[model samples]
Target: MKEMILMTPGPTMVPEEVKKVAGAQPLHHRTEEFYELFSNLNKNLKEIFKTKNEVITLTSSGTGGMEAVIANLFSTGDKVLVASIGYFGERFYDIAKAYGLDAELQDFGWGNAVDPNVLEDKLRNGNYKALLVTHNETSTGVTNNVKEIAKIADRYGVAVIVDAVSSLGGIPLEMDEWGIDAVITCSQKCLMSPPGLSFVALSERAWKMAETSNLPKYYFNLKKAREGVLKPNPDTPATPAVSTIMAVAKATNMLLEFGLDNVYKRQATYGKRVREYVKSLGLELLPEEDIASDLITAIKVPEKYKASEIINHMKEKHGVLITGGQGPLKGKIIRIGHMGYVTEEMLTKTLEALKDAIKE
Candidate 1:
């Protein structure tokens, strides 16, 4: 089979070194060696998150981390606001509602970023305990101003929970400096690893709220997970995705070694180049340039072309796998993911293939 370049949002291309680590024999979860690896990974994760909080690792997808945040931070019937800009934002609202929380969703439209001013307006009169926000909306290629949103939530004494699954390692998110209460991310996206491992870091304020949280939870319980980490040997209560953990440990170390600032700059450069190239080809983008995401770019499909045709043509002809829009935007947009271990040559090839696909 031909090696198809994965330009999708998640499960991005993995480095051979990281793959080697993941392919290694699984380590015993209760062993000293595993504990050391877990301990170091947590420390590295804290640095990546730019927070002093204990970053808990869960053996689940990014959505599981989102659900865990909802389960651990707020209880049933708690009034919470979900400020949505795209699909993931709606997912947050759905999770909140499923947990019996009074989750009020205030959608800011698909191609738009969440207005901090509008969010502030809602918090002032809503008497909400918490607000959920997605840092980067992959489905629409919009990146919200989470720093400003967190500041506004702080003013209203509302806890802020962010879904940074696709943005954390690729974007600049200072969890502590921004006063974000909790942030959820996974290994698959910017971390340049496989799926199955998700992470969540909480502020002191969030931990306090968890102490009295009445939500029903066992596997997604943050406190128990916290206790496991605090143990003398340091571990998770349940067996983790051992190979995935190893892969992420290797990937995070590589990022740290390369420096987080460099990673952010590279991602921004790639995003800018892709957007400019797409526009130069007479194609349109779903979101405005100013609000576009640095991890993914969603382009408007030309009127005469089908989204599926473009996606299929890119793969079948050029061995490049891109994605289409989701929900209401499906069949209307084509998304190209340039995050994690991507290069200038890869981007150039992808753009050339896209142009050919459109022309053909």
Candidate 2:
């Protein structure tokens, strides 16, 4: 089998050591062995999230965790402000609507970041229930100033929920310190694990809301998950993804071993290379430099040709799979993912192939 380097925003390359660890003897989910695994994962993820809150493990994707927040926190006819700067941000609105909540969206152009001032203005006097936003808009490669948004939401007595699926591990998110109530992350993106698990870090305020929330939630019930985690048995009510949990356990250990600070630095270093390489191709950067997310870099297409050609050539010819922009900016931008178990060498190699592809 030919090994191709994955440069897509999600499902980034997994380390061989992690693969080896995951392939090791599987453990039963009901035993003390699984308890130790869950406990370690919970503790380590708290460190990564920079939170003291309980980290709930969900057996679905990031969207499942997002739905969990909506189902458990919003009541019927409750109003929520969804920040829409990219595809992920728009999903919050969709989630709100699916749960029968009143959703107000603050729309921005793709490849743009959500302005903190806009959030403050919308949250100031509105009878809103919660503020939902994406920490990093993976589709456009823009990182929103969630800390500032959290501050605004805090001032208005509104809970702040973040879709941090793509940004959690690669970027720095101090959930508790930033006043984020519920933050959702996925296993495949920056977590360096296969896609099977979703993680949520919830503040005490969010937990309190879950207790009184009138949404009909059973499988994704937040209170039940918390109860399970606190129980003496340390088992969730549902049968957890045992094999994937094993993979996450090893990956989290590797992340801690590398040190969070060092891990972020690696992303930043590779991101810089990506920016320089893309600029060398006479293309522009998507997000503003200071506010760009280190997880992935979205490069603007040159005015000469269409971005579709580039995506096709890079994938079919070079076996270098990259992602086109999502939502409104599709075919106008292509993103290169530098997040998770990646090095400068990997980025340089991708850039070299991209250079040839564009030139041809």
Candidate 3:
């Protein structure tokens, strides 16, 4: 079999150490051994999230984490503003509306970042219970200025809910320092783990909202998850993904060992390398440099080339896997993910494959 490289934004290439843990014998979730692992997992997760808040783990997709936050923190008829820049941002809006929140979407263009000034104006003028923002707009490869946006929300006394699914572990996000009430992320992206686990951290203010929230929820109940984590023997409300959790526990430790700052700088370096090489090939990046994400790069596919055709060629001819745009930009742009355990050598090979694919 040909060696295949995954350069897509999610389910990123896993480190060998994490894969080793995942391959270990599955432990019973109710055992003391698992509890000890769970305890350590939660502690490391808090450090990555940069918050002192109790981080809740759920055995579901990142979207489930988003839903958990919306369902637990707000009631029906609660008005909230969703600052949408790309696909994931729009998902936050969709989730909010699905739960019967009066969701007002403050939409910016796909490849652009949310202007804090505009967000502040909305907060000052609009009647909102909370503000929902995507820390990284993965679709457009744009990273929002969460620190600035959080400051604006804080000034207006509006609760802030951040969808940090693609940004939390890959980048620096000081949730407590930014005054964000809640932030949700998954294990697959920068956490260097596989799918099936999503994490949500709640500040003191978010916990207060959960206490008063009248929204009906059962499986994704934050309170229950919190209680489970706080017990003498840590566990989950449902049978969690035992093996996946074990893998994530290992991945988290590896990330800390490398040092968070070093990880961020490494990802930045990879992104820059990809961007410069792609531009040298006469390709245009989707997002402006100021708002570009260090974890993913979205580039406009040349007009004559179909994104799908190029993607197919790259896979079949070179055994390299990348992704095309989502939503409206589909077939118009290609997204190259540099997050997780990706290396410069891997990216160099991907670029070579891309150049070959384009030529052929």
Estimate, for each residue in 193-309, the C-alpha lDDT of model 3 and write its tens digit.
Answer: 989999999999889999999998999999999999999998999999999999999999999989999998888888788889888888899999888999999999888999999
Error of 2 at 212 (Å): 1.0
Model 3: residue 46 alpha-carbon error in angstroms = 0.6
As a whole number from 0 to 100, the lDDT of residue 36 in candidate 3 is: 96
lDDT winner between candidates 1 and 3? 1
State the lDDT of candidate 1 residue by residue for 35-54, as single tens digits.
99998899899999999889
> Which pairs in model 2 have colliding backbones?
none
Q: Write the per-residue lDDT of candidate 2 for residues 157-226, one digit (tens) a residue.
A: 9999999999887878889888899999989998898888898888998888887789899999878898
Instruction: Assess candidate 1 and give its lDDT.
Output: 0.94
Residue-level error in angstroms, candidate 2, position 296: 1.0
In candidate 2, how many clashes are counted? 0
lDDT of 2: 0.85
Output the TM-score of candidate 2.
0.96
Ranking by TM-score: 1, 3, 2
Question: Against the true structure, what is every candidate's RMSD?
Answer: 0.8, 1.4, 0.9
- Give lDDT: candidate 2, residue 329: 80
* Predicted structure 3: clash tally: 0
